[model samples]
Target: MTAALHGLLTGLTLIIAIGSQNVFVLRQGLRREHVLAVVLVCLASDVVLISAGASGLGALLRAAPQVVAAARWAGVAFLLGYAVLAARRALRGDGGGMEADARGTRTGRGAAVLTALALTWLNPHVYLDTVLLLGSVAASHGEQARLFALGAIGGSALWFTALGFGARRLGTFLRRPRAWRILDGAVAVTMLLVAGMLAAG
Candidate 1:
């Protein structure tokens, strides 16, 4: 129980930090587009990553700096591209809620899922957090590492569920074009910052 609780707290501490994945999930939720799918991908991803970490894949990752570097560069490129799109959206400002229009179109399910995957898999920080930091912590639990991982996975499940579904309550506020502009602006800035940080690191 102690291990599980520790894992839960640690996972929450890492996962609750605002990042590209969370931002995408929140946006999809607000748009009411493939929320279930996106949330599931995120959860499933956490399951695999957390499990891999607990099972000692973290050690392999540490030995492979090249792998980390590849992911880092990929993430920088992806984030930069996404940030540009978001910036354009902010500039266009012809927004309606979750529809395909001249300014922007609602993405299809496949696109959403692919995005969820890219945002989840491409970010090197995800690896450092889940596979490195969390794994090292779980390893300290010795035989109870699995339980610790379970607790961490539980934290991920709870957070993504709330972040995705709970965003609907803000629909009223987000319906305005200006609200979307503000959101896109914020998203653009956040993406740029993340990319910059990843590059600098």
Candidate 2:
């Protein structure tokens, strides 16, 4: 119920953060290259991670308030730092930003899948967002924690499916580097707002 919706909203907020994984997915979607495989891999990984966080790991962290505080601070730091980077990307048109590796020659299905895996598993923030933050929130939900987790999973499915498939429509507009700057600006704002929320909690 409420937990489910909370999970869904939280999940969307975190997943929508512009990052390597997201950019990669958007690029693949635009190229219409192995979209199904990329989407499936991302969705499956989220299921496992979100379940692990909501089911138990979150509770463990809850038992340790100090640890949760530390994570909260770390998240704030990461979010602020990321926001700065995103702003710079928008202003400077940094080639090393999200679109840096986005435009190279397309890889085979296997490579694309592997890249998706790497992008998901390699990022440290994934753990922070899924296992720590989401888990911690679900733990706070008490009896309805499972519902929260499921809702988060639903968010993940909804976002990835839309990003992977719907991005094709935006392919024309995103071709302009200014559109990317605007995208980065929006992401920066989202990150700042989320960071503010985390810091306040």
Candidate 3:
């Protein structure tokens, strides 16, 4: 239970930030175009990635103490760097708000699914966050690693569900720079804490 909760929070903090994939999801939601398809694709992709990380990839790392140590430090460095970037975004209000893309003709379901797939699979950050960072963190839970991954998966489920289905209601607030500043500030703090925890371990 504890490990799961920790993973849930970690997943939320890592994923809640503004990014291309998220932006795409948000836009699809706002447009109300093949939202189910997009959301499903994203959720499926996450399941595969997170499962791989917590299982097969994690098993590989557990066999190598030196590799795990190096990866841990690397994760710490990455999280800290990300924290700094998020802090800058919070302070400077740069890349702070979602832009309103001009509404065009509704895209087909297949096209939307393809786009979601590309956004998720083709993005390097997704691999780093889901496979590497998340896997390392889950491994720290020891025997409860699967539970941790489950919780993280839950987080993704909740986030995508809310973001995709509730975009209409959230559109106005999400467009505000202040809202983004607050979100980014929280992200910065979360990243710092996660980085600290990894470093201590």
Clashes of each: 0, 0, 0
Local accuracy of candidate 3 as per-residue lDDT tens digits, 10-118: 8887778526457667767865678888988999998888888888575564466575566567666766776787689789765333442342334678977986776
Best by TM-score: 1
lDDT of each: 0.91, 0.78, 0.74
| TM-score of each predicted structure versus truth | 0.95, 0.65, 0.63
lDDT of each residue in 145-177, candidate 2, tens digit only: 999999999999999999999988877767667
TM-score, cand. 1 vs. native: 0.95
After superposition, which runs of candidate 3 have C-alpha atoms over 4 Å from their true positions?
A: 58-104, 170-201
lDDT of 3 at 78: 62
Candidate 1's C-alpha runs over 4 A off are 98-104
Q: Record all residue pairs in model 1 with backbone atoms less than 3 Å apart, i.e. clashing.
A: none
Residue 142 in model 3: lDDT: 91
State which candidate, 2 or 3, has the greater lDDT.
Answer: 2
